[model samples]
Target: MANGTTYKTCTCRDEKGKRLGANCPKLRRPSRGGDRWSSTHGKWAYQLELPPHADGTRRNPLRRTGFDTQEEAEAELDHARGLLALDEDAHVKRRITDLILAVLKNTKKLPDTEEVRRKARTHQDLNRQITVAEWLEEFLARKRRIEATTRNGYAAHVRIYLTPYLGDIRLDRLRVSDVAGMFDAIEEFNDVIAIERASGDPERIKKVRYRRPVGASSMHRIRATLRHALNIAIKQDRLRDFNPAAVVELPAVTRPKPVIWTDERVTRWRADYNARTDLARRARARVDVIGCYISTPRPSPVMVWTPAQTSTFLTRAERHRLHLLYRLITLRGLRRGEAVGLRWQDVNFAGNTIGVHWQITQLGWQPVQGKPKTDASDRVIAVDAETMRLLKKHRANQAKERLAAGDAWADSGFAFTDELGRPLHPQIATDQFYWIAFEAGLPPVRLHDLRHGAASLMLAAGVEMKIVQETLGHVSSTFTRDTYTSVYPEVAAAAAESTAALLATPSPSVLSHGRRKPSSARRFRH
Candidate 1:
């Protein structure tokens, strides 16, 4: 085991006023024949020689002062020796010594013996201490396989929320309360955002660029990112023993049910929309139009069109160049990106299947072609005969356009494209859908809602939930039931009648008769 010595020291001066340390006259022992040393003149100190560096460089001795008694100094020296004794390897001993030196330099105290032992036993680096901020940055750098959009989301959580709250904390020292407290602060800031937005003062809103408060769902996502990063730290890098973010509590995310645009709901929504538009018009006339905004929350976040409304929108869009795109999306449940990213070669008229192998995602305003959103999303959807016929017609039109453009045609091979043969931007498709619905006098429904409508239609037609899940590329049937099963009015009515018929009682007229009569009779041959 390592050993050390304890002695007295002081900051006294000689006759020339030169400072004295160990050479102080008050530190002398009475047995040396000098006047008895003053009891209150100096403090006890200790010094221990440490092992050399891994490369054999000489190391300075570990020395500390300011102990009230010799026993106090000696006790700390024993603690340091105990830490060095935990590991037998020379390199480990050197690392423990370094740990002690660092604690003394930064805190004016000895290293925790248990903490040192843990680090040594785990084979973790003792020379480098990582903070939460540093580890998050490193984690993001190693996430190479994730999508750019996903990476951007993780970066936002780290930069805007995580780093600002928990960045300075040591990675190992993070506690569940620390993570929870960060969320609490976020909720408080959310109140500020709401107050600013409700104030209706343009300058106040402009000062806080993110006018919307972070919702409970967004909070869940932030926690997910933090938890995932910490999991990797513990499982992959051995950087932490536990993830504080794992148990941190937040509000549950409640997804709104998809509501069909029934006549009653449509009338209510139209009245609200028209009122908001009128307010905005008047506000624009009174003030600078650039800064004026009239806001109204939608009835529901996810809304789908009824079959009649869907037919009306399709009829209005029938003459448009991308009519087939809208029709396919409505009937086949294709996402906006998937519809725009469809390639001609992936469509098989003979096989009656369309391969969903690629998508064009928007990174800000720029569009980039990439693999489908998930592994399940990359699937082959079977098409009906009528859809195949429309595909042929679309191809013929595309050929004529290609001939007209001649050398100017880009020949991008996308199933839906501009006359010049370039791929369609996803936003343009969304815009066209909006205008077509407006012209058709239909209540508003997002382009993605067409996919929801298709799922509802399938369920109304008595398709199995498992089939719907697979057709929509959902990870699970439970998710499909929870999110995509919007009840149609007719389906709901049929279910109610079927359930009531189970307990139906005989009528008074039938009870008065001698026997029950069959509602339907057929003659039988003898």
Candidate 2:
């Protein structure tokens, strides 16, 4: 052997009819033949003596059999002795050698060296392979310090998509083709969703109701989860080179841009869409149909109201209980969850500021109060005097409502809530927003569009991009500028004209004056 290790091979049979190993001819004269095992035609068996454990207990010699030649059996024994070079614990080495021997005893073949090394590294079961499903579970178990909502999202991806598709693949041996094939299957599933929705028959839809392909956003999310999980696998050295999830392409996901609702479009919407019997239940179709002229998607334009229209809306909604909540969003660009998460403790009437530290999100329909969307979202924003006054009035109104409720009142302390002080569901806000928008005789805008309107209005007011970014709790000013500025074309044009006028002012040059300094530089014409 390579390390001064010794091994023995024997084929039992002797002239005296004894079956003892000492009588085997191949063992007696292994080197005398032209080839190492040419002298034997019977089954060959091999044995090795591993070093004693630290406790001074001796394990039985690793043994295996069923080879046509002694050299073949000895070659297998040499492979086990080579594994000892890893220099692990004494007992561990013996255990590993025994495992190799056990496999050899059954299959008459040595296991792959890399596979054996991985088993040693991770201390996983050598008898079974680790599958993607098992690794995903391990990944989630190790991933602490995440929000409950975030954890739920990751779990849903694993349970709903990954386990069903890629679970059986060995984690270490996953290929790009397998991931691509999985996405292809998911695409086919999308076709099924479209088919089921179009079928219109309740029975047909019920048959395959649960099975559907994912959307662009879901695909992005699942890919992100897989990429993160596989990245951890790479960092832990569970995978060596390729993160197959990293390379497989997915459909492009573009953030929807803001589109302003001009007077003409709103006129078309009120005249065309609102003039229907199903108007109350299908208010979203107002924006959906109106947006079609400008975009092909069902909900084409992410409509934002003009400053005048916004004022008109506030005037119309002034008496509504939720007006203060909508005003906060329009002025401060708070997300729905942030608005719903707002508490009286976070409101600073004295400082004229509102601290945005917590937010309430939905995991399905259950409201979960947690940290803000991002680190930047936990901010203190300055509120206008009118907005602060409005909030004070809203609080007094809520107090009166609480008094009327008498012992039935729930003191949730939320800035916006039901009469019982419970946190409002986001969908309730959505439904209310549509109702109010239609009632105000205005073009329909998503509640989120108010946030877009707020950012654009700030830009129009000459607020610095950095300040607008901070106000909106955007991670980067560049994202804030690019995303929100699309709806500010009129403001952009006005700003451009102002800049041109400023640059158009003529400044007297030395050449225009009687006295001129000597200079060799001359202007060149294009």
Candidate 3:
């Protein structure tokens, strides 16, 4: 058939043989051949002109909807015919415009290209898209410049807790719910070992995995770090919400009561240490004479000290060091760090006071001249006469060693030092104190407990709370009271005694009840 366009007319005759007004309908198609209408079939159809192929030709047919009412159908057909008359390019453009308008109507708000670009730039400048890993890095960087002990603690937490659990999360997307879930997971892990032991099931191994949920104090530290990091993020506009750690309920942890050595225990341990120090001094004196003779070029005198003798001498010296640490703890009540970091300059023999100006940290002793834990901690403590004597003797011994070592000495100017005159590591001193306690057959206690012991002794001896507060460098008298009141047996006994006296005293009514008859007789006699 020839390629042609088609027009259709819907006709139904009236009684006069003319078409009725509603019976006839009109439709039209473009002259450029694409599809044609069939009168016999009463439908619109299309023919595809396929290119010649080696195997076979393909034909595609078009279909249209038919309606029983000719006028209604013809009206619809005319609309379609008008759409087909437009060029393909113009039709596509019109379709795209319709789609965009429909989308705008549905969305109600869509930023323009420039507005989106501006927002992107702002986000870039603020770096508001930082991930959890990036935030952790920044947090660690800030922490590294702090005290070594603090830095080590923070690093340990990041390594053990935060990074493994949350490193991948984007800081901005972190939510309270997510943190809660993590906490639950942590608790599960902490209980896993017990669960696994009870069940003994391989499949439940994950349930039994050992994970330690942080304690209340540790949780406080973690929250501090997280709050600090998130606050930084907020300042940079990277985060809009505060840290979830702040709102999470932390497990309560009661501080353990400080255990202090009794005076009897202190005396015994001190006596043992002093005996060891005297023995060490005698051995060192012998070694000094022998060392001088051995260094001489001419053969003057040969005196051999056996390995056992040398070992005995070394053991005595070791014991002496242990004693010194014990005296530092029990007598002065110095913290392990403060004792280890003490220098000659920090001690004033004339003033009989010790300056707590530095602390021996994990990284070595660091000067903290600005402030101590409180104003009270910064105060000068008057030394006891006995403690002053021991300190002066120790200083003389140190001076002798300094002269002997001469140029080879490290010259750290520390009051307590190794043979090389280098500052003592606080941890080492702490370990030695424990050893000394073991050797002295005394109960084990932390170096800090020494301070507590001092406070407890003062309280037991009727020292005023304010004096104890100032001596310990506590911020307030209340702090001293809280610490020492519980240990003061005398205070408790006195309170109980007063209460008993109040109960034992008879009321005025009881005393007067039996004397009424005698009073009237006595008045009549008078």
Candidate 4:
């Protein structure tokens, strides 16, 4: 319609096998309605001259053959002309032309005109063609101010899950189905991993690189990362109109609730652990219980020590060098990183509060000193009087050690330190906590569970949840309630009684107990 022609052409060959093309005699033969060309000779085709390149170079004509009739070719040519006419600006027309040419060249089809028109209307750069992998890499590269640990997580998600599954997909062409398929594949692979791990063959187990299958929580994170990247592509560059990852459905993740290691639970744990040990010994299998080989599964992934267990651990660790560190975390709910990163300057003995301004997180076993994990994480925790006294004693002990070491001491200002006064690595503190709990003949709980235990103690002591939330530096009370409200038995029982009391009707015995008894003279008169 703009400037195009439809004609018939064929693969008619000459005696020498050369293509006859437009010069074939059959094409010029008279057919119907006085037309010069034969109708049945060849297939119909259309050709149009697109605008020149921005550099003013002459461009090739857009051509398509193999239509069965001239009307089909003409209709397509008209459609192309309509797309070209949507924008009159030379630059936009050139972009539309290039889009059509590229799509035709690669896919043997014209670009979707409506999509191109929408992009043009939105002023999006139609020339940029990036794949999912490329955009993900670029997105990660642009996140300069993100925390190292968060960046590392993004990188791992991209490398392990995203790029491998969705890398080659054109960003604009990605669909919800494509994103959904990736998750489905991951779940299927989880089944494979489970099967391999359960198979006693060591070779099969070794093939399972990640022994733990990708969980619902990790899947959620992967989806989040993908969605974030796509959103940037849409909002920042107008590169895409929709985020397929956003609409994709995944299994819901249930946060593991913390369970208290009460006497009953601890007794059961010890019996199960001992039975496993005995079984392994009788079978002559060298069991690495700590490594989780031939060991008892925990009652819950998150387990908190009861007050008695906490006291027992404290008493056992009193002679240890890091006793104060363990006590601070147990009583104050300090994260392992925060406790490890504590400096002498952060402790205010007069105020009985320790400020949490710094943390040393582990990046694959390497210590990385940084600010607190979150803004809320930077807070001040009030220390109890007894714990404060222990802190002073620990300081005095450290001073004696420093005097004894003299030139050998490193003079590090950290509250918890190694023999040379170097800052304690987070892993080191965890190892010490684990060994101490083991030697104390207590059921195993992770070092971080000490913080959970502290929360339980505060709640059981009738401390307000908002206060506990602030003490633990949680961003919101709701998160604190959801996570730490798996309280001890006593706290749960108290809550139950309180709730029941709201609707309770006094029993006959309670009513009688409140009534005044009749005097002897009044009873005789009656």
Show how many residue pairs clash in every candidate, following the order shown: 0, 1, 3, 0
RMSD of each: 25.2, 27.0, 35.2, 25.2
Query: All candidates' TM-scores?
Result: 0.48, 0.48, 0.39, 0.49
Query: Top TM-score: which candidate number?
Result: 4
Q: Model 4, range 1-526, lDDT digits (tens) per residue?
A: 3399998889999999999876788887765667486777888888898898999997888889999988899999988888898899999999899888878788887776766876788787776667889989989999899999999999999988899878988887776555755665566356446656655678878877655688989999999999899898888644545466775645558657888887878788778878867875776444444433112456776688889989999999987889889998898898877898898899999999999988776532357687664456789999999988988888888898888888999987988888778788776776677668877877877677788899889999999998999998877799788887666888889888777764454433455656634552243334
lDDT of 1 by residue, 1-526 (tens): 2378887889999889988987897787576675665578898888888888888987887888999988899899899889879899998998888888887788888776666666788797876667889989989999899999999999999998888778888887776545755665565456445545555678877967854678888989999999999998787544445466765545557756788877888888678767756775664443211111111234565678888888888889987999999988898888777889999989998999999987775532356687654446778998889889989999999999999999999989899998899999876786677667776877766677798898888888877888888788765689788776545876677667666664464543554455544441111110
Which pairs of residues collide in model 1? none
What does the lDDT come to for candidate 1?
Answer: 0.76
Q: Top model by lDDT, which number?
A: 4
Candidate rank order under lDDT = 4, 1, 2, 3
61 Cα displacement, candidate 3 (Å)? 95
- Which digits, one per residue and each the tens of the lDDT, describe model 2 over residues 394-465? 999999989998999889889888888778876567556666776787766656679889999998888888
What candidate 3 gets wrong by more than 4 Å, as runs, is: 1-252, 259-319, 363-373, 488-491, 494-526
Task: Please give, for residues 1-526, the per-residue lDDT of candidate 3 as tens digits.
Answer: 1232223344556678985432243343335785444344333322222222233443332122345444554454443333323324443323422332344366532223232233243434221246777888877886656899878777776676666666668876765434433443344243333434445456655643554445557766765666677777766556653455554433346544443344554465446545544654665442222112112221111111122322233344355744554455554556555677677787888988888766564311122222233334456777877778878888788888889999988978888888879877554565454444444444334445556666765666667778777776665687677655665455557658667766665544565665445545454344
Q: Would you list the clashing residue pairs of candidate 4?
A: none
- Assess each prediction's global lDDT (C-alpha) against the native: 0.76, 0.71, 0.52, 0.78
Native-vs-model 3 lDDT?
0.52
Candidate 4 segments whose C-alpha is farther than 4 A from its true place: 1-253, 283-289, 292-295, 504-526
lDDT of 2 at 392: 93
